[model samples]
Target: MYDQATIGARLRMLRKWRKLSLVELADLAGMSKSYLSMAERGERALDRRSYIAALADALQVSETELVGGPHLTKDPVQAAPHATIPQIRTALIANTLTAPLADQARPLPELLADMDRLDHSKYKFREAGRLLPAIIDELHVHAADPADEAEHRLALECLIEAFQMATFTTKDLGYGDLAHIAAMRAGEAAAILGDPINRGKADSLRIHTMPATTWRVRLTAAEQAVERLQPHVKDDTGVHVLGMLTLAASMAATVAADASRARHWLDHAAELAGRTADAPGDNWGAFSTTNVNVWRISLAVEQGEGGGVLELARNVEERRLAERRGRHTAFLTDVGRGLARDPRARERAVEWLHRAENVAPHKFRNDAKARETVGVLLQQVRSTTAGRVLRGMAARMGLPH
Candidate 1:
C-alpha cells in the first residue's frame, strides 16, 4: 500500500482529522473496532467497492476523498471480482454524467418502447442494466428539450419511468449510489411532469433507493404518496400509481415487523387492484393480482408465517407471473424461506432458492431480504447433502462466508 494515499492511511488520517476514535469510527461504519483498525492499517484491505463507499459515507467524505483521489476506482462493478457487472459500468460511464445532448437523443417513441419492454420483462436484469443507462441518458435529453409544451410534458413523464427502471436495476445490482442518482433524476422529472400521480410515483420509489432511511420513514413516505394520489382514483393512471405506492407501503410495513399493519396496507392495495380492469403491465404493470400474491409470500416469510407463505405461493399463477422476472424472483425466494422454517422441508427450501439464484443471480445477490432469507435457510441445515448445496449456492451468490 502507498504511504499517504493508501486507503488505510487515509482512513486513519480522516478519522483523526474528524476527531473520531477507532471505536467511534467503527460504530459509524457498523464494523468492529478490530476490523476497522485492520482496515485503517491496510492489513485487511477494504476490497469490495460497496464497503469502500459505505466507509466513505461513514467518514462524511466523498469516495474520491476517502481513497485520496485517483488511487483506486470506487465502483465495485469496476473492480476485478465483479466481472459480470462491468458491462453496466461501461454503459453508465458512456454518457454524460448530468445531461444528454439534444442531438444524441433517442426518438421519443423509442424511449417509451424501452420502458414498455422493461415493464413487460422483455428486458431481464442483465439486459435492463445495460440498456437503462442509455435510456436514462436519452431521456435526459428529452426532459430538457424546448419543443412543444405537450410533447415536453410527455417527455418528462417518460423520463420519470426510465429513471425508475434505472434505479431498480442498479439498486438490485448493489450500486447504491447509482440507484440514488437515478432516483433523484426521477424526482426531478416528476416535478417537471407536475401531475399528482407522477409525483406520488417518484415518492414511492424512494422506499427502495433512499439511502440509510428507516423502514418507518419509507413506510410513511409510501403511505403519504398513496394518499396524495387518492383523489385521482377515478383516473386509471392514478389508480395504477396508488397500487404501486400501497404495495411499497406494505413491504415497508413488513420490514417494520408489523404484520397487522402490513396486511392492512396490502388489503388497501388489493382494493385498488380490483378497481383496475387488468394488469396493464406497462404502466404499473408490477402492481397487479399476481404481484400482490407474490408480495403476500414475501411479507409472510418476513413475518414468520411460513404456512401462509406456502399457501400464498400455491395460489400465485406462476404462468401469469413468468413474464415478470422481479416479482417471480421474490415469490420463489420467499417460498424457499418459508420451507426452510420446517426441518423436513429445509432441503426443498435450498432447491427453491437455488432456482431463484439461477434465474436472476444479480437481483438475489443484492436484495437484503433475499440475503436474510438465504442466511436463515443456511442456519436451518447441517452437513446433509442439501446443506452442502445451499452453502455452495450461497458462496456463488457472494453471501457472507
Candidate 2:
C-alpha cells in the first residue's frame, strides 16, 4: 500500500532543503501557494496536471520520487516474447507513426521516417496529447495484475513521452493551459515510475522557463535546474546540453532585463560548450558549434545588442535558407530577419510572417507571442512605407481594418 503522508512529508523535506518558501516556490513552479500547502499537508491531492508539475518543479526532483517512494521495489517478473506488454509496445510504435503533424498533407510513412531521424527521445520522453490515450487504456488493463511492474514501467514511459511532447509542442504553439495539463500528467507518471530524468525533463518544460519572462525569475529557475542536474550529469556532453538549456532559460531572463544573471548563464554555457567540443563525439543531442553560435546570436538579439545583430542575422538567415524544411523553418527565418532592423530586412520579415500566417493561420492567430511580435514590429517601424506594408499584410491576413 502507498503511504500518502510519507510522500507529502518527503515533498516538504525537499522544498525546505531547497530553501524556498511556499509562495516563492509556487511562483517559480507557476502554481498556487494554497495548492502547494495542501499537497504538503496531505489535506488535498494533486488533481490538475499543472499542480502536480508545479510540485515537482518546486522540489527540483523528478515525478518518480514524488509518486513512488523507495519502498516500492521493482518486482521480478518476466513475460513471454509475445506477451501483452510487447503487443502494447507494438501498438505504441504504430500510434507514434500515425500521429498527426502540423501539416496533415504529408504522408504518414514519410513523416514517421522524418520523426525517426529527428530522435524523439532527445526531444521529449513522451508524445502525449490526442494520440496515446488508447495505448494508456490498454496498458491499464494489462496492469491489473499486481506483478506487472515491467509493463507498468513501459506504460509510464509512453505516458511520459506523450506529456513531454505535448508540453514542448504546446508551449511552442503558445497553448499555455494545454501545455500545463500535459506537463502535470507527465510529472504524475514520472512519480509513479520513480525516474528522476522524467521529472527533470518535465520541469524543464514548465512555462516559467520560457523566454517570455523577465530576466531575474528566468535566471533563477535556469540556475536552479542546472544546480539540481549537475551531480547526475556524468560527462562533458551532458554538461554542455544542460548548460545550453540553462542558457536558453537565462536568455529569457535577459529579455526580461536581468543582465547580471544573463551574463552568468551565457558564460557558463560558453564554457561547457567549449569543453564538450574539445572532449569527444557528438553526444547529448548534437552539441555542435553551430548550435552554440545560434544561441549566442539569440542571446544578443534578446539583449538588443545592435553591433552583433547584423552578423548574427546574416548567419541565421543563410543557415535557415540552407535547411529549408520543417514547419518552423519559415518562422525561424522570419525571426532572424526581424533582428536585422534594416528597411529591406523588415520588408522580408513581414513577407515571411505573411507566408507563415497562410501556412498556419490558426497558429499565428492563437499564439500570444506571434501576435505580440506583430504589435512590436508595428510600433518599431512607424515609417509610411512600413505602415503600408503592415496594412497590406494585415488586410491579407483578414485582421480588423
Candidate 3:
C-alpha cells in the first residue's frame, strides 16, 4: 500500500475529481463511512494491503496508482553522519571521545542533573550521545562497588534512569531493537536494586517500548503490563506507574482499532491521573488531568476524529502542554495531521506541521507520515508565501527536492 499519509491526499484529490460522496465510496469499498473518511484524512494509517486493493478497485484505479506515487518518499533516508538512529547507535556502542569521563570525579546526583538537560531537549541527541557513553561508563564503574548501602541505591537509580532515557530516545525514532535492549537493561538494573515500586515503574517503561512492535503484539503486551501494575497501586509511586501503564495500554488499544478496549484503558488512566495529580512524574511523562486530556486528543487523532481532536486541542492550554516537549511535539503532529484533511484548515495544517518540526526536528523527519504530509502539501500548496515556506521546510527535511 502507499504510505497512508499520501493515500489521504490522493484519495481526497481523486474523490473530488470523481465527484464521489464519501458514502458512495465507503459503500463501494465495503467499509464504514467513518473509516473511509479517516482514510481520506491522514489520521488512520492504512496499514493493510487489502484496504489499498479495495479502495483502488472502488475508485476504478490501478492499485499502483493508489499505492505508488511521487508525492510520497517510500524509502528511508540513507545513512548521513547525523542520521537519527545511527548517531544513537554509535553513542551506545562506542565513545569516540579519547579522554575518559571526568564524570568519574563528579557526584552521581550532579552528573544526573546534567544528563537531564539532554533528555529534555528536542532531538539534541548528538550532544547527549557524546555525553551518555561517558556518563554510563562512569555510572557502571561506580555501581560495581558502592561505598555503602545508600550509595549503592543511588548508583542503581542513576543507571535505571539512564537506561530509561536511552530506551525512550531510541524507541521514539523507530528503533525497536535498541529500545528493547536499553529497556531490558533498565529492568535488569531495577531487579537487582529495587523495591516493588521501582520494578513496577521499570515494567511500565519497558511496556511503553512495545509500540514499535506489531500492533497485535503490542496490545497483548499492554494488557499484561496493566495487569502486572494493577496490584501495585497502593502508594504514590504505584499511582505513577499505573498511570503510565494505562496510558500505554490505551494507546496500544487505539492502534489495534479496538475502541471499547481503548476506552476501557483510558478510563483506567483517567482514574490514575486523578489520583496522581499531586504525585511527581519522571521521564515517562506527567500524568495529571491535563495530561490525560492531552492523551485523549492523541487517541482521537489515532481514531481520525479530526473535528474532535481540534475541539480537545482548543480546551487544553498549549503552553502548559508545550512545557512537556515530547507530548507537545506529539500533540502538534496530531494537530497537523487532523487539519490536513480539512480543506478550509489546510493552510493551518502546514503551519501546525511546521510548528511540530520546530519543536522536535526528529519527530517530523523520522516519521514517514509526517514527511508525507509535508511532501503532499508541497505538491499541492503552490503560489503563496506559506506554500514557499512549506516547500523550504520539506526540502530541509530531505523530501524529494
RMSD (Cα, Å) for all candidates, in order, is 7.9, 16.1, 7.7
TM-scores of the models, in the order given = 0.72, 0.53, 0.73
**Which residue runs of candidate 3 sit more than 4 Å off their true CA positions?**
1-105, 119-127, 211-213, 278-284
lDDT by residue (tens digit), candidate 3, 1-401:
23334566677777777799999989987778897676566554453434555677688875445544322233333112124445456444542122323335467777778777766654444344456656666676567656787877777777777777677666555465677777777787788875766676677677766433245566777688678767766866577777777888787778667889999989988887777553222424567667777788777766766444678787666666554666667778778877765666778888888888777665466554566567666656655877877877766655554
Candidate 1: count of backbone clashes, pairs at least 3 residues apart or interchain: 1
- TM for candidate 3 is 0.73
Q: Which ten residues in a row have the lowest lDDT in candidate 3?
A: 72-81
At residue 46, candidate 3 shows an lDDT of 52
Clashing pairs in 3: none
Which is the leading candidate under lDDT? 1
- TM-score (C-alpha) between model 1 and the true structure: 0.72
**Alpha-carbon shift of residue 184 in model 1 (angstroms):** 2.2
Tell me how far the alpha carbon of residue 132 in candidate 1 is from the true structure, in angstroms, after superposition: 1.8
